[model samples]
Target: MRELLYQINEHLKTVTFIIIRDNNDKSEAISDYNIITLKFDDIIKSVEELKLDFQRYEDSASKLAELIPRAEKPFKNEVDELKSLSIYNSNLFAHYYSNTLCNNAFNERKIVNNSIFHLITFRSIVNKSKSNIYSLVNCIKDTLFANWSFKNQGEDNPLCIEFNKPIRYYRIGNRNEEYIVADAALFNFFFDFKKALNKEQDEDIINCSSDDNDSDGSYTSYDVSRESSYENNHCKQIECQTFLFIPRKRKKRAKNDPCKDPVKTIQCYFRSKTHKLHIQFPNNNEPEQELKKSKKKFYKKIKNKVEEYKIEKQSTICPEMKKLLDEIENDINKEFENIKYKYENMN
Candidate 1:
């Protein structure tokens, strides 16, 4: 709760900015002082309350998306398709009204609630009826897209997951090396290795091929320079070096009932042509007394530091915003002058 309060303090400014920029069209700006002060408390609370259900939806959505095609007619596995769809739709209430962005400050919570509601019910998107295979396939495509979009919102590239290391590597790594693989390939559209453009796509392509999208594995490192949208939005780390290689399995497999169907294990391999990265971290060892401090005391100190940082950061709010606005205005003026200069010279 204390950590959340700290976040509320940090995010309150962004919420205020959103209201300010978006609320300007309202002619009664002077009378709208109340609208200018926005609080993300309710929004955060609502999100936290439903966070678990949203997570479950994501998991089931992935499962249904992977198997929807096989479950459709001709294959006639309607049981799986319908059951998965039922699971998906049942959770739709979790994000019931998600399509529209909140344009009104008065209804900010509504907008946020709707957006989050829409974000997690990610798989229900479809076009046309699911009557025929063509339509069903098309609709399935839509479902896949929605699921992908919600989870990997900022990813610009579209591609499937491919394996870097094969089955043997994962098997050996898991049992022997204490490194395991994911049940499925997960495409982390939020691939944030700052490098040449081509390599970024190269990086994500390998991730798209997983059976379970979110799994942990082995690490290798690569050089990281600038932070990408993924890092800035999600991670606070300044450097990057290693990546985990997770092994994936067949999406469709036999269920329990060993007498009828034998269990299967996914193969793992180490021979991946894609290069491995060598990760490094500085060993900033603390003093013995500091290291020996109680966790509660350390946490309190860190909390105080974070609070102080927020307090200091609040002072920069106006100046920083002014600087950005000035830059934009200057750029506009420069563009206008350049065009005028060109025209005058040409005449």
Candidate 2:
């Protein structure tokens, strides 16, 4: 997966047009409008086009897994191999084996290996691209939605577009203003749970650890207790931690009312009972269920996916992958410098 992302990053660097460099001096300054029209505009479009490729890669790889036999063949491997070659023809068998099938007669293993390979490859590409693209998008939003005072009545107020939604007003640093954030993100930026819990002076929290299972993993395990007498599974308890359940807001509806016709597929961040941020996204096609049960189930689903992603990120970062990524980024930086020089010289 890292290799595939490295490949995609290298490919993007070769495009030679997305680079933006500082133009601080008046003589060297590129017009903001030009920068927007070129860099920002092209980046947004490129991400969309790249998204198609990512999806295609995943689908193609999934199909590739199908080339392996649907079920395991426990008989003589030579007989199965010979039959496949004779029936599918030597050239076709060679192609299929090279692309998908392998000496492992275990169908499930073969399918899992191929499918996972492709899934990780495409996911890594999109994951890397989305982060960079969203950063640019946020910059555009901040610039277009910064705090503005209506001095001249005729002056236009800046506008911010929240994804596919209509243009809306935003006040910089204003928390009271209702804002929409629909990030198709994989994980939550864990809002410091301790800070959220420790905001007030009156509340107290307890922290604890023991001899088994939790030697290294240390996080703000919320003070989920009303009294100091509360003891954890492990007997020890330390002080100063506190938290309360933060119920997710929902529209007022009848107890029997079908889960408000499932909202659009969007990833949102919410404060959890433990005071940490968690991502939530409901599968739109899922059948409606009782509100509380349905929501709790969906929240767990999102949390599990985020945990898997973090594990993948950690395990996939080998020395070779790191070297490859460094090389690719170096090439990208070089291309960026070349483009910057060319653009400035031309201007």
Candidate 3:
């Protein structure tokens, strides 16, 4: 998957016009909006260079790993022999990987930590591209919904048509604004991971600063104890954190109401869970038993899918790195809950 993502990134960097339009329209003229220039040969060379560089990093990291007891050595060459390949100058890759390896020479963990570092860095890259991805998706959506009536383009276009619905106002940062709810949800998702990473990085910096100060024998026993306690608690949290359970919030309905419907209740539940479902419980009525049934059904469905997915993709991820990912995912889930609560209350 990482290799595939790297390939996709390279492809995106090279011949980079991605659009959704009429298949019959063969006008391949370059547009200012969606165009990037790079030869396929250059892309192959870049990948080859990356592979070579990856091996070098692996070897370097492995040698450094030998310095720490119980540290696993990094994976060796995964590169294929490719002739006449030139190195691509990528400061982002160099800077990130270099810092990941050299950030702390005294790190007790290196290879596994490096993998986790790479995973987070990958996520950061993908998060950065979310806006472009969103735009692409919107373009595809618009094309799919297009009436293609050039006679009255704006009037005929399905995308230009707007419908009224319940308004939900939410605050993001200092801005009190109204926008697509999904955009707000994605913003929260992106913000949570970034915020947690920033917080952790800041904490590490503070700890290093404190360690430097303490080397001069200015550290108190209480300060050491407090830091140790915090570290212990954090370790425990990571060890115990595997699954996150987020409860669904529902409005209270009157008891024994015949108007309550199970089908609409299930629909609403799924709709709230994901925007993919366009189910609407317009009556806003559901029996308590049916709601419970819906909750159980939802839980079971997710559990099965998660179990299958875990088994299929589990081998690539290191267990130690998986723990770190789980911790971050749990944090994101909590952040989502908080955002949901605030949004609901505002509505």
Q: Give the residue spans of candidate 3 off by over 4 A.
A: 1-35, 38-139, 142-316
**Candidate 1 local lDDT, 236-290, one digit each (tens):** 4333223433334323323332112100000000001000100111121122112
Q: Which regions in candidate 1 have their CA more than 4 angstroms from the true location?
A: 1-38, 71-347
Q: Which of candidates 2 and 3 is the stronger one according to lDDT?
A: 3
lDDT of 2: 0.29
Q: How close is candidate 1 to the true structure, as a TM-score?
A: 0.18
lDDT of 3 by residue, 1-347 (tens): 00000011222333322221233322331244323344444533443334324434433444443433332333221111111113322422233234334433233333334445476574454333333333433332343223222212232222211111122333546874332111211222122223233344342211211223323212111111112224443333211221111122222333432113222333333334322111222222222213333344444543454455568764323454345344433443454355445544644
Instruction: Give lDDT for model 1.
Output: 0.28
Q: What value of lDDT does candidate 3 attain over all alpha carbons?
A: 0.31
Q: How many backbone clashes does candidate 1 have?
A: 28
- CA lDDT scores, all candidates in order: 0.28, 0.29, 0.31
- List the candidate numbers ranked by lDDT, top first: 3, 2, 1
**Model 3: per-residue Cα lDDT at residue 100:** 32
- How do all models score by TM-score? 0.18, 0.17, 0.18
The 10-residue segment with the lowest total lDDT in model 3: 1-10
Error of 3 at 289 (Å): 35
| Number of colliding residue pairs in each model | 28, 2, 0
lDDT of 3 at 321: 38
| Tens-digit lDDT track of model 2 for 18-49 | 11122333232233421222232343344333
